[model samples]
Target: MSTEPIDGAALLDEVEAFHRRFNVFPTEAAYVAVTLWDAHAHLLDCFDSTPRLAFLSPEPGSGKTRALEIVEILVPQPMMAVNASAAALFRAASGAEGRPTILFDEIDTVFGPKAGDNEELRGFLNAGHRRSGVTYRCVGDGATQNVVAFPSYCAVAMGGLGHLPDTILTRSVIIRMRRRARNEKVEPFRARVHEKQGHALRDRLARWTEAARPLVDGVFPEMPEGVTDRPADVWEPLIAVADAAGGAWPARARAACLELVNASKTDDKGSIGIRLLTDLRDHVLNGIDRLPTVAILERLHSLDEAPWADMGGKPLDARGLSKLLRQYVTADNEPVAARNIKTGGGVLKGYYAADLSDAWARYCPPPPESPLLPLPPLPASSQP
Candidate 1:
């Protein structure tokens, strides 16, 4: 191996250029931007602790698989698998040289209606992110049988038609892919034609990694303030890799981390069930003992951008509202009880705050604590 320094900026540009030549992924700047760090991840000693890259789409022919193909070209010891059993993956991930960077395609099928068949493989994918992640399985015949510890640490890039399991998605840096538009254009990938150039880039990547590994292993790049917990663990390696790469990569990497992480949060909040509970607790039920359906619906519909207004093919009704609230109740037929809450017309069905308090605490983040003392009304001059 040559001892000369590598041009980190040039190498990063090459990664971005190669990725763009084949596809235009939705949320491209949020996700595709950091894939360069993923490519050269082997340079970091704790690359095993890095998160997996998930390429997800609502439909096929959206360039998801093609992007994984590109990753296979860029990553080290690439193991491209359209389908493989847990046993096969476990054994392959073992042996002398070390973990193979797994490039998995058609990952959605693994969790289809017959998901029971692939739980083992799913477990493997989830556990493979950290160094301590391992699967214990018996090997050899009856007399020789012994439980062997299979190593499950390696970089992974997966492409599929829909979302992965929540556990797996949380551990991944997801790239949402979409069909190309009329104005977009890209080079059609043919393995025979492109593998040569890909191999050349891969070799240079390997050389740079070999020379920079020690330096990268010793450095811990500063994380952005909003990033912490699992988000911090997942983005740390990418940031470190970017820091090693130098130039505009550090800025681009941090921006992608914040953007993608926030996007994931938005996606979670967009779920109807989550929004219902959060809105109920924060806007409708806070400090109140109970609220009738009419009052609840009024408050729900008034909240900005809430889904209740158009839920169930029209405005949310008593039955639909009851059905939604039942998820938090956890008992058969114990939904929003039909208590007669006082109203102008007379009495109507409503929900008691005690019933919802448990669900709110279990599912939602604790609301910001109310101030101990109410501030005096603002002066007329100061009020906007």
Candidate 2:
């Protein structure tokens, strides 16, 4: 292994060559290879200090695990594979001389809808990413043991499960994997045959990483725009890695950040949020103009499978529906309010046509009514 500093441009070329030789799908392989290259470079500097994580999530039969296996060969330090107790993980991470890369297969099994199994994993992963090492009590021979601290800076690669725990997801660079089509074929990866080539590429990458260390450490780039909430945290290091590389990486980093993070944000699992409710309310206002309490309730009930069906703690009954509408309507403009100006019952108990006018214009614009639209006729043979 050459101890000389790496040429970034040359390193990239080596990566491309190695990828073409063994990598099956260029698109998926390119993404994973670039990410690994970037991450490995970043880890060289302050390898003991910085904590980082990458997630490889692909559809079933996608080569995510195989990609990680390739990654293990490239990174300098020995990587441990684990699917066990959080304590054992922390212990191993703490004992490593430098930040050890931990490859977690099927991380979602520990964090997905299984409930209790996810909590400890979540806690440990969260703690491991912090700048300061985490401290926990160890059980010793007798009485309570003293507090033991574990290094927080380590690189983690997780595969299996598309959705990760929100905490880990926020702190990881996500690589989406696609299944191989029938036509595309790659040579079987043999460790002995490819080992030398992989090592050469890794050595070059390591040297370049050393050269770029100063830049990575000095410039901690801000999170890309449009990456809010949990995903922002996850991509931060990856973005930082890209920033260190310079050239077109800065722009590419931001673009990838926006694409992946924004995609996750747009995944609406039928949850009730302001946008959904606003749309639903606008739909009702445009169709019926002003509706009575029962009419509104019927409309809300009709939308049982919609977002507003179970909004505000119940299945939007008359009272609950009226309460929600009252927030937007005014007494003077309502029909009931106009008829019984003195009585409290007649006061705008629900939404009025004028109250929804603005919302209608904004959310559900009026479409021109069809004139003499013809209906579909029965089959010609049947009609005859």
Candidate 3:
């Protein structure tokens, strides 16, 4: 291993070289390569005693499997590729060297609906991320085989479609792959030649790892603010790896966390659910707040006039609006007193903005009156 430090620019150069040699798109491949390097770096430091998991997912024909093949060659240590089984996996992992990186391909097949056939494997995958190991007895001949326990420290690289099981996803760094553009070209990966190049890169990475490993062992950086939920735990080490790399990676890691890690809450369908809630809250604050179910229906209908109408589908109707609101607000089956109207008609129910103060504060905070609009004269009876 070389004694020189592995800088970000050098890392990028290596990644670009690998991408060209392997015939993978730069945007998708570069990011994955850097992240893998970072993950490996971190494993050497923080989890020198454990294993880590990386999942590469993209739509069909996006080259996830090929990327894994490249990683298998580049990551240092005694690496093996196989479909992980509960017993075999525990056995392999139990004796893995420090900071092991495990690459699993077609993980969806292993954990999808058909995963039921291998419940023990699924359980192992789930428990593998934690700092604890699992134990089970072997049912053998005369005397039951002694129960065996295995260590759960290993870095994983899994590739497949859409998403992984939540259990695994919550603990893995996800790399999204994208299809190569028609205009882009990559050199063919000639095994005889590329294998040598791949080995060279691995040697460089191993050297970098040996130098940086001591700095990261069992130490993790604090997570950035505004990051929440399971992704925080899964990515903490990856970010630390970036930090350990020192230049550019710190920023890149934070950006990746914000971009990919926090992607779960975003919806591509439409803005109707949150927007309708905002409009309701607006109406409430204006004191025109309470409207009969009919009035609410009318306002929704009016949204068809311009901008809102073009948002998605038709403007929400009472039933459609109610169903959508059910996700974030509560309602009752019996008639309830409305702000400005009395109930007793055919309408048996209605909803109020559950909490306008907070929702409005976030979605539609009060804006200062436009100076450009002409102000109405003071009430006729009173002169300014």
Candidate 4:
């Protein structure tokens, strides 16, 4: 290493510039988030948790794999894998050489429906977020068998089609990739020429991280409004790195944090129960105070392109709806169960609008604000 001083902020600028040269990220925030994530990996020992970097999209050729390839050249001891098993990952993560920066491509193959169950790998991904996280396994044979705890903590990045499990998704800085448009352009990544450049930047990042680690180790940078809990934990290290760098990065980091976090909120597909609640608020309720069970079912079944129309080859029945909603509570903290509602001739089993309020408020996005229309022109005679 050189004995000269390093300018942390300028070094980060170079890293960000390098990414822009090869990758057309979805937004400016994606660039900032990925840059900070690269720097944070070098300072992993300074923080209690490291957020997983996830690049996901609905289709192929959207640069998901390219994003991981870029990350591979920037981080320390990069271990790139595809279709790797849990046993293999565990061995790699616990290798004596130190925790490798695990970059997984085609991660959907490990967690997607066609791949079947991978509980061990899922558990590893979840536990690895925190410093103290570990997994136990039986070692040795028969008489000599002993349960040993293996360290699961490591910096992880993944690229794949579609979504990850909710456990992993919540702990990640997700970049939703999209195919480049006709006019959009980026340099074709040629490893022969670019690998050396990326490696050079990687070296500078490592040097800067060593010098700045002491300053950022325990620093608690302020979070933007509405950023708290798991999102706060996921962003803490990245923001801390930006703070140490100084210059425009501090403001840029916070802005990116808020933007990405809020975007995740909007993009969240949510559970089926939550989806039902949102549909009820947007469709069936329509300002009515109450609705009969049969009436609600009719409206739900009539929705085109909705799962309710052909759920397991049948329309959503009252039993299924009840089962889904029963897990939630009402405004009064009572079970959201159907009760007797009086009709002209007799009573019918139905739901009160009041009972669904709590679930709707908690699970659904706020209604969109109507665009303010300009007031009609004042009458010619009335104009002063």
Q: Estimate each model's TM-score.
A: 0.77, 0.65, 0.63, 0.89
Stretches of candidate 1 off by over 4 Å are: 1-3, 28-34, 113-117, 269-276, 279-288, 291-384
In model 3, the worst 10-residue window by lDDT is: 329-338
Kindly list the per-residue Cα lDDT of model 2 for residues 1-384, writing each as its tens digit: 556555564455456556555445434434533454445533644432333444444456777677667767677764656576777677766774666667787766676555334666677777776556574756566676766666555566677666775556556555666676787676789989787778776766676777677766645568766565455545555566666666556566677667666554444221232333354454555554555555555665676457456664566666555444444433345412211122234643344565655443443323435666798998989896
lDDT string for model 4 (178-231, tens) is: 999998889989999999999999999999999998989988889888899999
Candidate no. 1 TM-score:
0.77
Residue-level lDDT of model 1, residues 88-120, one tens digit each, is 787778768777888889988787544534779
What are the lDDT scores of the predictions, listed in order?
0.76, 0.57, 0.57, 0.90
Position 378, candidate 3: lDDT: 93
- 1 or 2: which has the higher TM-score? 1
Question: With candidate 2 superimposed using the best TM-score fit, by how many Å does residue 238's alpha carbon deviate from the native?
Answer: 2.8
Number of the top candidate by lDDT? 4
Model 4 stretches astray by more than 4 angstroms? 142-145, 302-306, 310-315, 331-333, 344-348, 370-384
* Candidate 3 lDDT by residue in tens digits, 321-368: 556655542333332233344566644345555333444444442443
Superposed Cα deviation of residue 127, candidate 2 (Å)? 1.6
For candidate 2, give the lDDT: 0.57
Ranking by TM-score: 4, 1, 2, 3
